[model samples]
Target chain A: MQLTERHRKYWRANLRLTGTLLAIWFAVTFGVVWFARELADIKFLNFPLPFWVGAQGALIVYVLLVRHYARRMNELDEEYGVAEDGR
Target chain B: MSRAFANRIKKYYSFYTGAFVMFVLALAVAEYMGMPDQWIGWTFMAATVALYAGIGIVSRTADVTEYYVAGRRVPAIFNGMATGADWMSAASFIGMAGTLYAKGYDGLAFVMGWTGGYVLVALLLAPYLRKFGQFTIPDFMGARYGGHTARTIAVAGTILASFTYVTAQIYGVGIITSRFLGITFEIGVFVGLAGLLVCSFLGGMRAVTWTQVAQYIILIIAYLMPVVFMSYQVTSMPVPQLVYGTVLEKVTEREEEIMADPAQATARDAYRARAEEIGRAIAALEASGSNGESLAQLRRDKETAEAKARPIHHHAEPFPGETEAERDTARLNFIALTFCLMVGTASLPHVLIRFYTTPSVREARESVFWSLFFIFLLYFTAPAYAVFAKYEVYTNLIGSSIVELPGWVASWAKLGLVKVEDINGDGILQLAELTLNPDVIVLATPEIAGLPYVVAGLVAAGGLAAALSTADGLLLTIANALSHDVYYQMIDRQASTTRRLAVSKGLLLLVALIAAYVASLKPDTILSMVAWAFSIAAACFFPALVLGIFWQRATREGAIAGMLVGLGVTLFYLVGVKFYGMTKWLGITDVSAGIFGIPAGFVTIWLVSLFTPAPDRATLELVERVRYPSLRG
Candidate 1:
């Protein structure tokens, strides 16, 4: 039950990664969607920026956020000697 | 992938592909044999139900663990597909494009909120819950909080949220069944309910999961085929997903042109003249001091006149806000709606439970990624469907002579789904003369484009698949909560596995019957009811589940208190503002009731935890174990 230095390091790394990814999540979802109207004045690939972002860009970003979190968490698990054996 | 995993994928792939090919051949034969449209629709409905029922029967198992969690052996990719089907209910499949067609940019709240919530699921809940490895969400609550009281509260929240959600799905089933089978809506509810019970009650979660995978295939194909065909028709481009940007630009240009046309201006003037006449008539009735019945009659007439006039005045535009205050409210509404939906998606019990069926924590994470990937296939195509459907309507239908309008319009008008009155007496379809229920857009698309009648039947089957897949998952969640969480765990405490499984099956039937009766009543539109369900889930369960995993200091008392307050406040606000027309509290509407309840729950849990004693050492250790899998006992 005792918390060791190794556990503390793994936990801190996980939290930091989670925090950073969440910030990006907030920026893409809320930040981009809220300012979508202002971004409409700009065009991307011949489509309105906000429209393209709202319709497609935000979702792709969300998928990447999840994929990154999974890969990083797996790395953290292995580094801390806690990874599943893939039974 | 491992050899075993690859083989499982190949097995299911070959099975589904064979089934799909056979169904297509049957449909082709039916068409070539010159079956009537009614017969074709009935055949599609019957064949699909038979296919699902067959899968359910084959996968049926009486083992308690398998019944509850599919034996926790589902491969990641397959689980992801099943979850995607469960997640994309009737609201996503049937109503999403219609909403986009009607609301334009504002409706992207649904798109963003739903898909974005997967991130929250992957990071905040699914992996840890999978590591906990419980049969149900309430099981985690009970063990983590160390008492039956927490479990009971958690069960109550799950039932309330799941029941509301399942009712909407059942309502969607009724709509699809009645429209396709040419039966009454009540009859459709019973038929759909029968299909739902057979698929869910026979094998429980095991049957439902496999059936859901098959349903996902049907729904995705049914949804994409018409839209892709339409896209090609419009832009000579085969990829609707890529070509829609040009369609959107064209739609905007056409809207601007229509707004400036003199013909539109004349139609608007005529609509205004009718509205003025109605207003004068209403004033005359009021001035004469007519009786209440006559006054009511006059008001109804006025409403009819206005309904006929409004669309001409505001056709196919983003939510119109003439003032700064109104614009601000619209923006706030958009943000509030999206935030609530995101949290709600993460907190839904049925969705959360799907993660528990994954084989490991890593697979749980992978499953979330695949679920979003499968869902994106549909979400990416929805806006294109809306744009192309709108383009078709704006270019071809509006301004056509009423007699020359497409045959589908007359047929749909007969069913009251589309209305055309030729209000200007020009014998032509003015924009004002035409109105449509948004639900019919997806259903009517194939016919509008003059595709084979069988495509319409295929679309109906797809809609049914969407509704039934979600219903199966939700019904199982409610049944498990009742039989496992309450009956065996709380009441008996010594029930055998067989007995528990039997009880769960019985409870599933009872719940399905009740949901069907509610669906028969036709309570609300599919999307609105779904929104309400999401708000309830977000408000009640989101805080407890998220904080329980992340915040080691969170106590049982705090969790229990937060759940009760959150559920109570959300239900109170929704019932008050929505049903009774009470003024919104803090300018927050019922759809975003979570705006008030979520924070209250989070703050209450944090504040109360700060003042209370810390949880026992064992409980803290369990939290650590859930957080770090290597430490699991």
Candidate 2:
């Protein structure tokens, strides 16, 4: 099961995207919750910033992250000529 | 699926949606035309259950693939909706707003943790596993690890976790049924069990998937109606998610007013004195060394106080801690619980199996996104629902004369879900004097908003759908463990498809009946076991499943040891906290016991795999095939 340069390149790109999205994930989930008291002083759209983050912002970000990954991977599969449909 | 196939599905379901809408409208019209409230409730419950059962009958099958994985052709959006219904149990549908109402900012832990798990699934699991193409998680265990032992262990693990999980859902069924249908709880348990059976027992995943899609529609609509209506009434805004601060301002003022009012202070003192008097009586009985009926009665009184004790909470606070040390522990507990839920969500067997029904690796990843999106609809509005409910109580219910209180209050109080006490000898209701259980907040929402009886019926129907959908999945997961993994895979490898399906159906009926009986006993222990299911799944499969897919060097021995170690640590921590008089580790509750097990599992897998010989080439190739979405045959 030797890997070609094309395979290596696609895997690397996928990993990079996942790492970047997960970084945003960490910041949103733990960082926002951890500093919620301090962030409460700030307001966004007339809602307390931390409250908004916990209730809606973080969830929206999660949805986008997954969607972006799925779309990117599909394109990557096509570009690498490795898609299930043999693009 | 091909475009034409997708178009046909859309055409058929469009008609279904229209018919569902028509049924509800007709019921509403019937209510307007002097239909008895009891009859409206009966009609709503019966009509929805009958429709689901009809879908089940139409989808009935002896084909193994269709029964187990819905022919692996479910569309992305429908699978997503079904997954949403499957993921949302009684807890999410009926209890979330109530939790949000009670816990305020801290309660978002559940919303974030549950939804965030789908991200983990998309990145780390769904695409790879869907590419692997298995009937169940245990099938993956057997194939990847190349043995029956790992598969057997997984079957046992699946049955253990999913059985308790199903029992809890049945308990929810009983609760909602008794509340709305005016039946006893025991009868409700069996009645709801029949509805659950028709969906999964007949058509298997094919039926359950479609049934769940229909259920997701009812539940999301039912959940949103009261929230949207109340938001319009309070702030003249129909979209509840965006109108947060508008209602919060009034709620804040009321909180301050309640805090400063002398009558509230008097109410608090009265509560303390009453609790103290009961405590003193119990102490006297114990000091007398009497094991008489009087002593037992006093003990029950004390337990009642302990059960109803609502700790003081500030609606705006993030995490409550009076001191720096307590704050640190609170922070630790919150993060720990969130992490545990995220891992558990990825590893849950009932949820993981949903991915196998998708047509391809790409759809699996996309469906995870849809799952999160559909779930996000409700999670986003739950906080606003809580805030608006609080505003209503603060502005309208509180400070009103007790005798003149709204009929909704008396109605809920009759069920003992809402307790009102005139603690200060004043007839006026104070915020402190009213204790509303979490179930009351959601179930009573329609009544609180002065909505028609049909809307209340609709809410109850939504709750039934949520519970039934989850229960249907759990029942199948458990039955499959015995029938598919054990009987078909291990015991009767040469059995016909018909025989195998029959065994599965029989096992399913048996398991559902057992769960119903356990739920009927009204044991509080099942509720606690429900919390343990997440931890159990998190510990048993998270590390093994992840490494089995990603790391080719992961050996059979390594996986088994990791799962066992993880399971051992989780049970140890849970038992230690529950019965061994052990303090919580860094204030982490037993619900999140996976906090300890997950790390222990990862570490154990690393150490064990390093010491053991690497797996053979075929097994390693299986891992590679699973990891890459576009691998050539």
Candidate 3:
């Protein structure tokens, strides 16, 4: 369960990025969905901003989150010389 | 053979066989009462209760691991059987077929969504979660986040998700009892409750796992027999897969028959045209729903259409003739639902925990493959069942005298079971009069197709298997969360194994009571409630789990924040649209809510991870350990 210096750096960046993404998630979900009536005026790719962000945007974010986390983990694991089999 | 090895196998079979035989005998006695099938259902259920109680009286340890993870020594094949039993409940076995029956192609979404969800779990979540090596989800959350705060959020999410899912299962039990066995809805709730209590109280995971394996066999048999019978009757082909083409041909022939009769054709055409007009008006209203006035106008138009079509009920839209608008709406809804289901399956605690029951990682993978293979056997045949059931309803159930309406329908309806109204005064029941309780299609199938009461009895047994297996799994998860996550983590970390076992049993008893109360609420379709659970899971845990597995830097703060946001958004959307009047505020239809919630979860996890202080190297190493399974001792 020992951690290397590279692993420490990787976690530092990962944690910070997670916070930023979460804030955006909350702002979009509550603001757009709860206040959708007022926000319908906004549009993304011709979709109402509320509609676009709530539905399509959330799914896209899920995929991106997986990819980002996967890549970051790989980079950190490599830097620490942790064998692939260790995970 | 080693004495210990022989002793182990002997003990396992003795326990399993003894319980099963007791169940069968009880089922026989129940069938003998000639009580309505629903009442007879209780008889068999009561037997399971007695059998489990009997086991509790005899067994010594009711060991901790046995209670929670079935000793965590179940072979992959056996564990797979138990998992299949857990996953394919009354909802999948009974509800899905009925949905396909009622909705046509649109219903295919449930099957696709369900099967496809597991792919996400196998690839994205299972192996990692397994390697994390915890009793419950909160174990991982608490350890990874390195704080009680993170565990609290994860706990809350698990409770919300599990409670919602369990409520649906309870509701399904109530429904099946009322419809099949001649019982009041409340009576059905009690029957289901009694069965859950007995199964849950027995030796915990040990009892539940073995019971689930048995239930899997019963449910699969129950699910398939009627399907096989229907296929044989409709196509003269005994296998379900080959029968699909035959059923389609029959429907086509029926359409031609109706069309050739000018009088019938005219009536059908008028009904079809009126329905199309109403559909177009509804679309226009959706397109221009900019204000209250437009909404009111749309409502008025809808009222007019309802009045005109009041006597005439519309059959399903022709599979090929669906309009571009209809297809677009269906496709969008399909994707949204499928995505939610996939994510939800990946995060479902009970299902995930079952994977830990297997002895090895390779076994877990093989178990999933087996589950899918076993599942596809029925899944591929389900569409055929739907088509044939529809055909039978249209061709035989309507217009015939009560005595003549398929012997089983008459038999069942006599018990005040199915009541069809001739809304148009046509003196014949139309397909529209059929109530859409998808579970009914499977339960009523034997009776619908003129099968015997013996077949009916077998189906009832099957339904019980489905219900009990799922109840066993869900109850165990509830118990583990209470003992491992809530109590061990939060209350007293120094508690002994015996103490934990005692607390878990007590928790199981408490959950049984709560589950009974929830089951009494009696929701409409098992499938709908299941979908709601999936959407919530996708919105909450899926993003966090996926991110945590891959992102070494995912700090406890970001994980907690992501779960809270994802869960909050999903709950808001579900409660607002499903129960309350929030859909109007958002100008979003109920069908598209997940389109908004799922991505919100993902973004929250990823974005939150970036801003929070990262976990220390120790936590990252744990993450690295979870990311790979081979190193597990």
Candidate 4:
């Protein structure tokens, strides 16, 4: 039950992936809301940025974030030989 | 667990979905053939609850593994659907669109926070907990932090938060059931309890998990159908999300036009005069040293006046006010509330337990993705639902002659749920002439869209599924905490597995009944009570659980200190601000009290763990296993 460099490497990779994704998550969550009034005037196709982001865009981003994490982590686990029995 | 078994499950569910759809269509036919709306309502209530109960009976198990975590072999997609159902309470299913309809842009905090929370789950908590492999959240607390004290405290917090949350669900059922079934609220709550008990009592987590998957399907379909129909009805496009912008623009224009109507101003003045009259009466009562009787009368009057209050802000408005001070306050409250909800989503015992049902850490991660996708089906549609329902009102109902108002309005008015009057005696409906309770928008959408009564019945059934699924998970969490954590772990370590199962079932029933009684009492505001539960969960468990995974140095003492500090600050602020009239500190509203408690808990855990002795070698090894899935001893 000794710790190995391999374990540390895998953990580090996982952490890095999580960090990058979360930084984007943090920006999308608060940024859309904070600059909502400003974003509203800068519309794409006549839909106000604030309204679209608050209503729908942020949720779509959430789905994408989790999808990316799940995909990347499984691949990371595979590369590190740490993958569980894929159920 | 095998490929054959998984295929069998897929087949069974496919057949079940087909049958359920056929059943609904038959009901629609019955409605078209002059079947009574009462019969449709009763049929939906009976059939859906019975369907869930039957699944519970079929999935009933005596094996401890099955009882606790469904033998830990549930596939990713099914687990995701179960988690979606588990995550969406009556609040998300029933209240969310209504909230969006009322609060407008501000309501996205609930949507964003709840969905964004799953990101925390997938990235931080879910896979590790599955790697740890336990039946309940407290199991991790006891094993990782290493003591009964931590486990017991975890159990206490789990029960309290789950119980509070479950009562809100049942209370919601009381409203939905009584409204649909024509039963009294008291009877409606017990009916909801019956639905909950039959699902969770028989097979514990196994029953609840499968039933939740079924419930998720019902709820998502129920939520989307009316909304999609309305969107298509209004815009000739079936996709609500795509059509949302156009509908929103139209709604904004209507809001501006309605705001400019002189009759609307007359209505506003009448409301102002009424408010002034009440203020004067209250002042006079206080001057004369008001008696309890007079005070009670005034309180009732105030309540009436408050309910009469109409929306002053437009749906597209950024927040509550145009002033910078108010905008600043709204934004802060929004951010705080979102953070608390995200943490709470990660920490709730019922939600965390869903991860344990997956076969492995990989399934846990996959299931989270699926959960968000499934939940997004409803979340992405809610704002669109709000705007289109608004469109229906703006285009069809408002500015119409009073004599031409629809039958739905007359019926809703008869129930006192909607108020429409020609206050200015113009014989035309102004926006002010209609005071619609936000709750009615989702429920009334089918009829408002000129759909048949059958769709309304379907929506009611979907709402029931949402409440029942969430209630079942919560009830199981509470019962398991008592029977597994308290009784077996503490009182009788060598208790037989059958005995533990029996106790869990009995406690589940007892807890269901108690929650039913509380719901019968009809607490003020399900959303507020639910928010309170979330803050407590966030403060109490979020710090301890996250730290225990990452910081092997988190001793039992540190965990205990963290929980107490977190719970203490949350309850203190909540009680003081909610009950004692304490001015909110830093304008941190009462709902986001956990924003304070979370920081306090994290700081306390860090300081206490450093000050105390480090956890032993075995605990450190356990942390390694959770952190790196490959690092098996």
Candidate 5:
């Protein structure tokens, strides 16, 4: 149960990656969605900015966040020698 | 390719081939026999039942692992599709656009909240839960907390959340069947229940998974077809997804024009006048101590008058916030709703169980991405559909003569989904006179666009698929939670796999019957019930599940206390505000009821854990292992 340096390093790296992604998540989900009204004066692709963010923009950002997290985590797993082999 | 892969491909090929052949035959019969619209609806319903029944029979399995977790062998892509179908219940497929149509900007809470939760799922829950290798959410709860009490609390939460959700799905099925097949709502509930049970009972998760993939196909096609046609008709653009932007502009422009028009102003004034007259009459009668059928009739008359006036108010000022205070409330409600949905989505037992079916932690994460991608195909289109459908109502139906209104209007009106009355005796359908239920928007889209009757039937089938797919997943979750977590693990730990499977299947039937009966009673609106389900899940499970994964210091006492407190606050707030109408007590509306429970739950968990002794070293190591999959025990 003792934590090795390797375990600490791996945990740190994972937390760091998750933190960065979650920050972006907070920005996209809460920041954009909540402050959308302020950006309403600006229009995007013929729709109001707030409307565009609520309808399409926020969702796209969420998908990218997930994809980025998955890709980075998978790489982290490999670097840490924790990746599961295809059974 | 492996034999199972080849067999899956062949199985799908034959299934699609058979479905296509049956569809064409049904079309031909409709054309040749000149079948009525009701018969067309019946044919669609029958085809769906047969297809799901066929898949269930084909995938029938006796292996307990397969029944419980689809043998943990589902590939990411197919699992993603099945999960997509499982995630998008009747609310997403049918009621979502209708909500958008009715609420406008406020509806984005659902749009953003439901989809954003997938990010939380991929980041926080799915991979670790898959690594834990549990059959159900309660399994994780019981294992991590190491007790019957934690497991039982989880079972209670799961049943409460999933049962409410399954009832809503069944209600959606009843609505769809009654509208399409011209059957009574009660019969529709039983029919939909029968279809749901047939697929789920035969093979459990294994059958449900394949059936859901097939449903994803039907629902997406059914959902997109009408909107695509409507978009092309309005904007002369084939891609409704892109063209809806232009439609929004046009609709806004039309709204302004209607607001400015003197005729519309006069009609609005007349509606207002009538509403005020009824209001005063009711008040005067009450003041005079009138307390008989006449007073009740006056109240009913006032309700009808207000209903007639509401659309005019909408046409005049669509969004909720006409004033600054209203805007703040709307904004607060929107954020609160989205937060609740995100937490609820991540906590849902039925959804998390899908992750357990994936082969690896990586695949579980990958499947979350795919689930979101598939769900986005529908979510992104929902707003566009709302825009076009609203435009259709605003531009054409608002001013048309009642006699000249389309056949679909009469049919929908007969079902009380759309009510058009010339309150002022002006043969022309004024905006004030049209009271359209949000549920009718998607159903009427095909007819409003002048599409073939067959396409309407297809939409009905798609709705049925959406309802049935979610119901199957929900039933399985409840059944598994009861059988595995409650019966086998807690009551009789030495039970055989065969005995467990039988108990699970039996529980599935029992739960489905109870859900159908409740759905037949029809407690609330589909969207409202769906929203309440999210609040319940958010309060009951979100804190415990999230903290269990991340905070190593979290003790079993803290978790149990957190869940109980969270669920208790939510139920109290919900019942107090919703059933008892005690909104003033907590200043919490039904939509924002989770505001009270979620934060209280998190604080309780944190505070309780800080005071309690740290969990045993073995439990800490288990948490570490779950966090770092590379770590060896």
Candidate 6:
């Protein structure tokens, strides 16, 4: 398992981005749930505010996080001299 | 025949076709004997036991990995089948339909959330975890965080989540048993335990996986048959929700007529006279300027009056009572339960584990599409059966003057599986008038639709399939945590695989006992309990897992902080709010509000990770190694 300077930078960036996104994730879940009534007045694409957050918003974030992680991990693999196949 | 040709012929015929034939034959024989649907449930219980016995004769590996993960060489297709079996437990097959039946449109959240959780597993968690995989969820936590503390916390969380979830499955078994076997609830639990022990403990993972795959097929077919038959009968539409909604229109009309015709109804004079007595007593209270007490009395009288007037039906929803607020509360609770179900589906562990079975990341992605396709087959039919059953109750069984029900009803009632009571004393059975358990909606489908005896038998077989498959998968995970993660990795790193396998088998037995014990204690509801488990998982694992995969600088301290805070918040909202009241604990009025737990976890993880130093270059390389499977084990 060889690690180069490029790997270090990529890893650092990945960590920072993950941390930021996660913080936002928490805010969305707790904030919207606590203020469901207030948010329910707001709608996205015709869904009630709370319903949008609960059903659609949470799912979209999950997809973004997954794509973000997969791409970052692939980049880190390239820098570290480890092939994507782990050969 | 040529040797090569014979082998090819034998391969397809022997394994796949033979098993299919045996299952069909068993089903046919059970149906033929007039053994009833409840007795048909035994076919699954028998098949699972028989499958385990066969696995024991074929495999003799003493290696722990062999027992825990089948030496990690399971073919992708076989693994997918097993995973399907693992994912579609009793809750999915039995409880889901009933919920949709009772809740209506709001229940889509459950189906969507559950299937969507697989997407998270495929792209985000599974491949990487498989790359880094050793045994248990705690193993990943311990390795990523680099410590015994992280591992210990992960293990505790897994146990908490797994144990709570498994208890619900056990409770399901008990309910099914009491319904099918003419047995006491205690005996039902015991019967469920005995079957689980044979399917899981006797064979360990090696046996459990294969058996689970079989169970999945049985359960899925069982779940589908009744819904399909019912859908065909009503509206000729195969879609479940449409059938349910269509029946809703019919039921609403009947209810309206009953409400209007109460004044001129000739039947139920006895109950109507009693209701008048109660109604007058309440009217006197209202005349005395006692609004609060008078309202309570009036509400009770209303129930009595509705019962008398609607003596021809059984399962009526409570009428619009005195207070608008109370009616709104019922509607609100229905909405909240639906929300909990949808969100919680994304957080289940056993379901998450299924994605790991796929060989490539792409395959994982495709498999989910297949799963959703397979799931939709029954999912669309569920509401149909639910509504059809409700309509059956309303139309025929409610207030009819027949002391004995029609053949199917009498038969099911004789099994004590579907009980009835003459609530309004009209001597007629109103099927809709019965207070049906949500769990029984799918289970009771064959009887409700007046399907052939064999169809009813098939329905029972399906419930058993769903229950046992899920039980086996959960038991295997629990066993791995004890044997591979705790005993081998943490306590004794140098322990031989053979010794570890022994411990894993022992743990399987112990956990099965514990689950059986917990199931006997009985919880509030299977669906709600499942939600509690999921919310706890989302609070604890989802954040940590997401962060671990994407963030290279995620510190041990940060991960730990995030998990603790998230779990604490989820628990406070779930248990604390229930016991202490939301006002005293968090000053929040709505219990459906998950409060601050999810965000609290995310923040704690991020801030703590930032404050701590990043992983060393060596650990970063390990992360790289795990990301790519061809990088070498």
lDDT of each: 0.84, 0.87, 0.63, 0.85, 0.83, 0.62
Candidate 4 structure quality by residue, lDDT tens digits, B1-633: 456777887898889889989999999899889999999999998999999999999999999999999989888899999999998988887778888887888898888888888888888899999989977888898898876999988998997688889999999898899999998989998888888888888888888888998898889889999988888888899988887888888888888888777776776666656666887888888888968787768767665554444446768666666578878889889889988988888889999899998877877888999998998888888888888878888878988899999898988887787888776688888776687777788888888878888899999999999988898888888988898988998899999998999998888888888889888987775446678888899999999998998777888888899999999999899989987999998788899999999999999999999999989989998998888766543
Q: What digit string (tens of lDDT, one per residue) describes model 2 on residues B1-633?
A: 355776788788889888878888898899899999999888889999999999999999889999999999898888999999999999998888898898888888888998898888888889888999979999999998877988998987898778888999999999998888899999999999999988988899999999999999999999999989988887788888988776876787788787777777777777667677898987887888878888767767666554334335556677877788887787778788888888889889999999999988888988999998999998888888888888888888889999998899899899998989887888998776888888877888898888999999999999999999999998998898899999999998999999999999999999999999999998877887887888889899989998897678888888888888999999999989987879887788888899999989888988998999989988977877776776653
TM-score of chain B of 4: 0.96
Residue B577, candidate 6: how far off, in angstroms?
2.0
Residue B506 lDDT (model 2): 97
For candidate 1, write residues B1-633 as lDDT tens digits.
455874776597678868886786688687888989898899889988998999899988988878999988888888888999999999889889988888887888888888989999988998999999989989988988779988999898888789978998898898889888889999989999988988888888889998899899999989988888888888898788888878777777777767776665566567778878878987887888877887777677777666655533122233346676766677788788889999999999999999999888888888898998898889878877888888888888877788998898888888898988766677877666677878778988998777888888989999999999999999999999999999999999998888888898889999999988887887755436567888888888889888888899999899888988888888888888977989976566788988878998998888888888999998888888888867522
Ranking by lDDT: 2, 4, 1, 5, 3, 6
Query: Per-residue lDDT tens digits of candidate 1, residues A11-75?
Result: 88988998899999899877876676567668776577777777788889998998888888988
Q: Which digits, one per residue and each the tens of the lDDT, describe model 3 over residues B1-633?
A: 234543675577567756655655565565666646555555655554565555444432456666676666676556767778888777777777777776654465555555555555555565566666567777777888787887777777666667756766666677666665667888887777777666667567667776676677666766787778887777677886554654555665675555454444434445456666767877776787666666667567556434433332122232222465654444455556555665677778888887776554544555555555555555666666777777887687644553355555654556554655443455554444433345567777887666656566667767766776787678778778878888988899899988888898888878877877766765444335556776666666777777777767777777777777777777777777777766433344454455577677678767877887778888877877775433322
Docking class of 4: medium
lDDT of 5 by residue, B137-159 (tens): 99998888888888899999888
Error of 6 at B407 (Å): 4.3
In terms of DockQ, the best-performing candidate is 4
> Measured by TM-score, how close is model 1 to the native structure?
0.94
Q: Which stretches of candidate 1 lie over 4 Å from their true place?
A: B1-6, B269-319, B524-528
DockQ leaderboard ranking = 4, 2, 1, 5, 6, 3
Comparison by lDDT, 2 against 3, better one: 2
- Candidate 6 residue-wise lDDT, B130-240, digit = tens: 767566677778888888887877777777777767777778778776766668887888777777777666556666666666665666667776776777777687755
Q: Show pairs that collide, candidate 1.
A: none
Model 1 per-residue lDDT at A54: 73
Tell me how far the alpha carbon of residue B277 in candidate 3 is from the true structure, in angstroms, after superposition: 17
True contacts kept of each: 0.57, 0.63, 0.01, 0.65, 0.61, 0.10
Error of 2 at B379 (Å): 1.2
